[model samples]
Target: MVLGSAVPRRRLLLVALLAAVVLVVAGGVVATRLVGGPRTDRGATPVLTPGPSTPASPSTTPSPPPPPPGADITGPLNLLLVGVDTRVSVPGWEPHADAVLVLHVPRGLGRAYLFSLPRDLVVDIPAFPKAGYRGGRTKLTHAMSYGSRVPGRPKQPDTAQGYELLRSTVSGYTGLRIDAGAVLTFNGFDRLVDSLGGVDIYVDQRVVSRHRQPDGRHRASAPGGYTGPQMVYEKGRRHLTGWQALDYARQRYIPGGDYSRQRHQQQLIRALARKILDQGLARDPDQVQQVVDALGDTLVYAGGGRRLVEFAYALGGLPADRFVLVGLPGSSVGSGGSYRGEQLTTVGRRFLTELRAGRADAYLTKHPTLKVKT
Candidate 1:
């Protein structure tokens, strides 16, 4: 079925800017500066590969033009976006997938659907021959860490290899073949926002910072928790600095907890989409060029075979309005007191079924509640 309507030409280009200038791991948007910092192996290609192979077609005498709207699509391109939670750069640090978002964009490339898997979701991560990880049942966040272990050097963990293993785990869990993916450190997320001169977001709730002090310095440690006055993000439409946006997106102590954090993260990306248009970054070639150059510092990507810019251009037809934030419902899994992790409910599993079956448009219509409110 058809998804997004006729997108204005200019806005379509901006959406590409959203993917290129800002960072999109597949899900609507990820949170933090996205942790791992600049790599020592920056020039080396990240070994990104896709699974559940595609149908091989004979070499065309002349390459065919891209499929048009309503035409058969070659993909159900499942992209894995994982935000790494680490204070140090890759290899030196063992990181987890702090925020996991899976973006499913159909072969049609007409529109895309972004959904999140709770970091605390409990699952059995399978064996990884690369990292020598045997795997076990634990929070999904740990999958990255387990996969990141540098086999020979125990102190160093390869984050790229980490994504490789996390990818396999996610593909198995969701039953969606991950075609392209990215591993963004918390640090990268903030730089992107600041590069855009900050974003204007309508904060849905009041969030008191648990990490930062009133003056923007990190809070001091205390017996039970952190000390000093906290930075507060008052409820309303306000311009968010990079640090502020990251702080807000990382919060999980609010009423809705992690779910609230997820929603706000989604909102941040939407705001970023609007900010690019409002700030006119999409139209400025020089400014856009700067963002492209700086983007490599922000996060590392695996295009499954293609370059990141190629993916950006291929999905350029996608407009900002077409990004659908899908919310999956589930509850904590554990005993009376201690918490174990999380597992998706039947409704959540059903969504994945429809996603793989290429019927998300119809599924979303039937269950409007599943769509995160814009």
Candidate 2:
């Protein structure tokens, strides 16, 4: 997650001209399309579909490519990292998200950047038949709700279909092509956390989370009770279990709410990344197997297995300092008046304008290397 956190550092990590670069995370059991089209069904077995493809073998390793050249800026290289929340039983949870970030990894001159698009940013929902929904802007997250049934297609009762709608909706909104996407569920997250053993996060404020066993339903801290919010942990630099760490990332009822919650989410992710690399989690076969088993049936990436492996390889060897993180710049985007509604706020037009104009190159040029503290 810390390696992932470099996404934000791209802002100042490039040399102070950072505002909102993002890393998108969607934690659902869904899969999406390649450059264009609908997502594949979750239950569908992956077949050796013949096409123009590159086969990856252990003997043929990924070569060390040169850094993205700075001058050749064109269209936005946006990556939508969505954390899907498939937690039903809660009311109106369709558009609800676990974590959502959009990363703008530069091809040249500038550093990789990130933008945290608030789930509550209200926007329009394109037309849908059974949805009876047509062009009316709602929270950005809500667009995912209409995924199962495209405007004219039949509802197939497939969650993977919903994820496809989400992928298309986000691409449409930014006018940026989504090069890649990945989806994981709460269980996948917990398994990943456990595989890494745990991650350390600095708890700035005192916030207690309570819940019951069997079903990890989150609650607020209170006095002794049979079925109420259980106090999970105290604030400070501490190690967390899979469930505890997930609760830390999943808590949304903080005093400052989503904005503050988003910031902390990045922080924890960074700490976890640092821990993963430090512990050499990938090198340990036992730990890797454990993580794989935990993530079983829960890990799904768009672009197929080969593409996913390629991405993993590209990112595998990057030094810790090569990372940067940033968040979208702007005022509060409303939550669409519903807890489970999508965030429908637009990014600062000026910031996005600069990004589209390739000003990030100058920003990256001015600040190539910056120091990161532990």
Candidate 3:
């Protein structure tokens, strides 16, 4: 009797997992809707370009070389997806890239790999023209901020320039040519989740908020009229609303810190994808349009709206098992170190080499533990 009960429960879980995978593929396609309007053959997708003026370079700061002549993206396609804290319009504010993911879609679109780069990864940033800033080693997230900053110019945001700079920085570090890129605002992500009527994700562990109160206090308990920070999520299956999903994905107070948050972020993507598929958004043009509309003006992509739509459509049929998730191997430097940062491990170098050579599957086979289950 016990064995029979276990068998049914396991079967149910398997079915749910399969359903989630299908939804994720559908969701990935719909997520591209955030890029632009209905697909039309009117023109090529808009490409991001650098600003006209060049920044004065210091002796130590070397100018970035021009990108190699455009080559037809054959074989695997690499896309840099950056998640920023807020839309660029906030006056005098330079938003950092809170999340950076490299989405690798294999040649046949048979499988997809998502590799997450922690925000604190130490990397070299190139000088920006408008900013008159010399390049230096800094947190990977700061690459966007340095690119966007334009001293002696208007304080408004220049997302295109920022993305271009970040693209260059990532390309330099990864040794892979970035075919396209996307900048997604956190607020936009929240709305996308809400539009799908929320998502169901399996939380692997408890998640506590690390965001501080206005008075610079870590809200740990409700005392003296203080409610403290809420425990955003507890371990197990959770059907999260838009705001709750965002909070859950953003939490870094767990055991793994940013690494834990990175996993959650990737999980959220898969969950959202699953929700979209389960809701049949792919077949309903009106529903798809609604999802696009909810994204508003927040999503900015390198290729025009059409390219994203086309790419998403092409890969929509991929199964969930075909999706693989891995983090760039790295260890964080302690706070008191000369520079509190993260250094990529030797295995990370091997992973990058395999990725560049289109052998990520082999790498995964050798390092089975890195494969993240959706």
Candidate 4:
């Protein structure tokens, strides 16, 4: 009788364990579907499928090409973060990338580095088939403009085509094969900031708005038109709202001009990253969902939802301080009475070499001024 009772008890325990396993498996499925599921029109941003692939022979040696200038050598991931300013008033105006940043997340995923490319830097742009402008050397910002319109064709904005051309041009210039990319419109950026409950950043100096006039109109706006309220940021640490943060970053009339604006932009990135991690956004499912929704509205990635979620998860292990921001070393050059473009200095090339070798920290040690902090 004892042996029979023991056998029945064992069977009952086995059934209980199977039920638990099924529940666990079901839960996992639900979680993945909620967070990393396939793309949809409303939730999934349109993914840019990579161009044609070239298959290699089994006997071919599998070695990566030499790291390009400003390329990351430590890992496979190189992402381009573009901030585009779309002009609605101009009928045929294509959006231009106001800011371009290369985010290098190494294979180990311990830390990430961001390198900013100046918009005014002169570079060679290939002839775009759609735009009639037989492209030659021009400002880096013009690549997007040239790519947005088809030459001799009706005025239609092709942002996707523009992105591809810009990607190609950037890849050629940086010597890094851009594996993936994201474009964030200015409007989206503002909304993202607001969603995060604002970000805290340290303003190095008191920033007076050069774009705003005393009469409460933007310098660029029409005489009678309203450009919203003007903002003046005091020096030191401050919590900024979405519009305030955007205004702070858009200040080009400051002492350093565009370079200063670039630095401020980098600071904004750091502040946002730090804020997200500090607020436990990653740990909270509800918060994560909210952020994902916000991103869906503003952010477009080449890898779609899955890739974006995967990348976010990969960075979960990293602390806020692991993000490092560095500026490409360069100076302004010009001819005659007009202002010319900027060129990367010798130090910049050396900096790229160190970056490719995965020793940016060491490079920063040598040139402390290039290091940016929020």
Number of the predicted model whose lDDT against the real structure is largest: 1
1-374 in candidate 4: lDDT tens per residue? 12224334433222221111111111000011121112344544332333455787888975564322122223446767666776757876776878777777667766777778888888888877766667788778878778877655557765656766777788888777676565545543444456556778899878987555544355666576435455678899898776677778878778887788888888887776665555432332222233344433233333332334344434444566887888777888788967778777888768767777778888889898888866
TM-score (all chains, Cα) for each model: 0.76, 0.62, 0.71, 0.71
| Weakest 10 consecutive residues of candidate 1 by summed lDDT | 27-36
Off by over 4 Å in 2: 1-77, 89-95, 108-111, 128-133, 150-157, 210-229, 232-234, 277-301, 304-306, 329-347, 361-374
lDDT, candidate 3, equals: 0.61
Alpha-carbon deviation at 126 in model 3, angstroms: 2.1
Residue 73 of candidate 1: its Cα lDDT?
28
Q: Any idea what lDDT model 4 has?
A: 0.60
Compose the digit string of candidate 1's lDDT tens values, residues 78-156: 7777777777745557887878888787776667788899999888899887788887988888888898888788987
Instruction: For each candidate in turn, give its C-alpha RMSD to the true structure in angstroms.
Output: 9.7, 10.7, 15.6, 15.0
Better of 1 and 2 by lDDT: 1
Candidate 2 global lDDT: 0.47
lDDT-better candidate, 1 vs 3: 1
Report the C-alpha lDDT of model 3 over 1-374, residue by residue, as the tens digit. 12223334433222222222232242321222122223342344332244576667675665675432121223366777777767445676786888888777778766778888889988888887766658898889988888777666657656556667787888899888776666655534445455556688899987766544434344564554436645456789888776677777777767988888888888887766555434432332222223333344433333432333344434444555567788666887766656578878888768888987888888889988677666
Global lDDT of each candidate: 0.68, 0.47, 0.61, 0.60
Question: Pairs clashing in candidate 4?
Answer: 130-150, 130-151, 132-151
Off by over 4 Å in 4: 1-75, 130-133, 151-154, 211-220, 223-230, 279-300, 304-306
Which number leads on TM-score? 1
Name the lDDT value of residue 365 in candidate 3: 91
